[model samples]
Target: MIRKMELKDREAFVAMANEFYHSDAVLHSIPESNIEKTFDELMAGSPYIDGYIFECDGEKAGYSLLSITYSNEAGGLVVWVEEIYILPKFQGRGIGKEYMDFVEEAYKDKAARIRLEVEEENERAIKIYEKKGYRQLDYLQMYKGK
Candidate 1:
């Protein structure tokens, strides 16, 4: 099952997030401070962000973070799937596809597009995403962060 993240989920969420950032799934590790800040932002009821915790047999299995933004090119609201991480033990059980389905169903009416970024080297994830009908965007993504 997947549900909105709550304050009580902090410990598990942090552990999983830290693992995710440090694993091959990501390009680099982020400071733990950033993880804490993300939790705080999610808990603060921010309108632009949403967090969900995935459960398997009543155990915390993983988490996903999503961000919302308006895109003129997309002609409406865009739902950016910022992060998705499943515990190592639960990795092959089709949960990722379930999460994708959930996101699609949840935003079908409100969003013009559902977007996400995947590391080019992460071939496994790329296959799953491609099977789910996600296509690569040709433009290079760049950001200037403070």
Candidate 2:
């Protein structure tokens, strides 16, 4: 089951987030600096971000953090799948497909398009997304951080 993230799910969020990014040496051993406040605010709910916790067989399995925005091109709300993390042990069991399907049902009426990005080298993830009908865009992603 996929449900709205609660402040009480902070530990799960932190754990899954770190595990998901474990390959990034820079963040491997780092603690989340604002997860407490972040989870609190997110659980409070808003028009912007939507965070969900996925449970499998009555246990915490993973999460999906989404960002929503209006897009003239999309002709409705566009949502970015900022992150989706499933515990290593829970992977390769079709849980991801179910989780994504849940997201679609939850936002179908409110969103025009759902999108996500994967690391260029993560071939497994790329294949999964492709199998789910996601395609690569011709545009490059450019970003600036302060």
TM-score per candidate, chains pooled = 0.97, 0.87
lDDT of 1 at 5: 98
User: Tens digit of lDDT per residue, candidate 1, span 6-29?
Assistant: 999999999999999999988889
lDDT of all predictions? 0.95, 0.80
lDDT leader: 1
lDDT of 1 at 78: 99
Write down the worst ten-residue block by lDDT for model 2.
23-32
Model 1: worst 10 consecutive residues (lDDT sum):
137-146
Q: After superposition, how far is residue 69 of candidate 2 from its true place, in Å?
A: 0.9
* C-alpha lDDT of residue 84 in model 1: 98
Deviation in Å, model 2, residue 103 alpha carbon:
1.5
C-alpha RMSD between model 1 and the true structure: 0.9
What's the distance in Å from true for residue 127, model 2? 1.6
Overall local distance difference test of candidate 1: 0.95
